[model samples]
Target: MNTKAEQTKGASAGDIGKLTLAAVILVAVIVAYTWLGNGNVPQPVRLIGLLVGLVVALAIGAFTGPGRRVRNYIAESQFEMRKVVWPTREETIKTTAIIIAVTIVLSLLLGLIDLILKSVILDWLLKLG
Candidate 1:
C-alpha cells in the first residue's frame, strides 16, 4: 500500500461552468456599481447585493453535484492555509531593520561617490576656463 497522500485534481467542465457563473455575477455587480452614474447609490444596498449574490453562488456550488467537489476542494485549501506558521513580531521587525540598515549604507556610499565625481568635474571645467 502507498503511504503518500492522493492529490486532488481540478474541476471538470460542468464544475467550471458553475465557477464561471459566479464570476459573471461578480462582473455584473461591478457593472452595476459603475452604471449608477455618480457613485451615489446607497453604499449599504450595494454591499448587501454583493453579499447576497456571493451567498447564493456558494449555495448553488454546494448543492450542485459537480460544483460540490470543486467547492469542497476550495474549502479544504483554505483550512490548510490556517495551519501555516507565521513569523513572529520580533522576527519581522529584525528583518525590516536589517533591510533598512543596508539601504541606508548603500545610499550613503553612492552619494559620496557622486560628490567626489562632481568635484573632479568642476575642477576640470575651471582649469579649461
Candidate 2:
C-alpha cells in the first residue's frame, strides 16, 4: 500500500537482506546445475532445478518495493491493451501488400539510379581521363 514516493525511496534493511538471499540462492542453483552436468544427473532434472530456483528468487523479490511497481505496470498495460483498436486481418493484409509494393518500387528506382551513375562515371569520366 506504499505510494510511489515511498517505493522510490531507499530500500530498508529487510528488503536488502531478502534481495541478497534471493541472489545467493540463484547463484547456488546455477552452480549446482553446472556441477550436475559433470555428474550422473539427468538434463531434465538440472533444468527443473534451474526453473525452481528462478521462481523462488522471483517470489522472494516480489516482496520488495520495485516488484509491486512492476506488477502494477503490467496490470495497467493489460488494461490499456483492452482499449486498443487492432487492425482486422483484411486491413493487415492490405497494409502489408502496400508496404511490399512500395519497397520493391523504391529498390528498383535506387538500382536504376545506381546503374545510371555507374555508366556515366565509366563512359564519360574515364574517357576524359
Candidate 3:
C-alpha cells in the first residue's frame, strides 16, 4: 500500500502557456505604470489603469495550475496555524520573569569572578616581577 500522499501532476503545456500569459500581463502592468508616471497622465487615470492591470494579471494567474497550488498551500498553512497552542498571558509573564532573574544572577556572579581574577593575576602576581 502506497502510504505517501499523491503528488501533484507536472505542469502541462497549457499550464505553462497560462503562466507565461500571467507573467506578460504583470510585466505590461509595470510598464504601463512607469510610462504613465513619466508622462502627463492624470493621477486618477494612472491609478485606475494600475488597478485594472493588477486585476487582469491576478485573474490570469488564478487560472494557472501553479496558482491554484499556491492558494491551496496558503489555505493549508492557515489551517495548521489555527491548531497551534499559544502561551497564555500569565505563562508568558512568568517565563519572562524567570529569564530576567537568571540573567541578572549570572551576570553578577561572572562579574565578581572577573574582578577576583584581575586582582590576583594583575595586582598580586604581576607585582612580584
Candidate 4:
C-alpha cells in the first residue's frame, strides 16, 4: 500500500490542465449566475444553472489525477481512523472535567498574582511621588 506522501507526487501537465479547467468552469458558473441575476432572470432558472455548472465542475475535477489521489487519501484516512482506540464516554467526561478544573485553578492563580503586582507597583509609585 502506498503511503499518503508517496501518492501526492508532482502533477503532470495533463493533470494541471484538468485542474485548471475545473477551476475555470466553477468561476464561469459564478459569473453566469451573477450575470443572470443582474438581468432579472427567474430564481429557479438561476438556481438550476448554478447547480448544473457546479456538477460539471465537480465531474471534471473528479476525473483529474489529484482528485483520484484525494479520494484514495480519504479512504486511507478512514481506514486509519477505524484503527484508533476511542475513549469511553466515562473516560472522556473525566478528562474534560480535569481539564476544566485545571484551567480554572490556573486562571485564579494568575489573577491573584496580577492583583498583587498591581498593588505593589502602585504603592511604589505613590512613594516616589
lDDT of 3 by residue, 3-90 (tens): 4586668988988998888889888988988888988999889888888988988888887888887887788888888989999999
What's the true lDDT of residue 33 in model 1? Answer: 60
Give Cα distance to truth, residue 127, candidate 2, Å: 3.1
Question: What does candidate 4's lDDT look like per residue over 59-129, in tens digits?
Answer: 88888888887787798899888989999999999999999999999999999999998988898876788
Clash pairs, candidate 3, are: none
TM-score of each: 0.54, 0.89, 0.65, 0.80
The true-versus-predicted C-alpha distance at residue 23 of model 1, in Å, is 2.8
- Which candidate number has the best lDDT? 2
Where does candidate 3 stray beyond 4 Å? 1-4, 96-129
Q: Estimate candidate 1's RMSD in Å.
A: 5.2
Error of 1 at 60 (Å): 5.1
Candidate with maximal TM-score? 2
Q: Worst 10-residue stretch by lDDT in candidate 4?
A: 1-10
List, in order, the clash count of every candidate structure.
0, 0, 0, 0
Q: Which candidate, 2 or 4, would have the higher lDDT against the true structure? A: 2
Q: Give Cα-based local distance difference scores for all models.
A: 0.77, 0.90, 0.88, 0.89
Report the C-alpha displacement of residue 32, candidate 2, in angstroms.
Answer: 1.2
Worst 10 residues of 1 by lDDT: 1-10
Error of 4 at 48 (Å): 4.1
* Candidate 1: regions farther than 4 A off: 1-11, 36-41, 58-95, 125-129
Tens-digit lDDT track for model 1 on 37-126?
Answer: 367788778777777877776775666566665676787888888988999999999999999999999999999999998988888876
**Prediction RMSDs, each to the true structure:** 5.2, 2.8, 4.6, 2.7
Q: Judging by lDDT, tell me the better candidate of 1 and 3.
A: 3
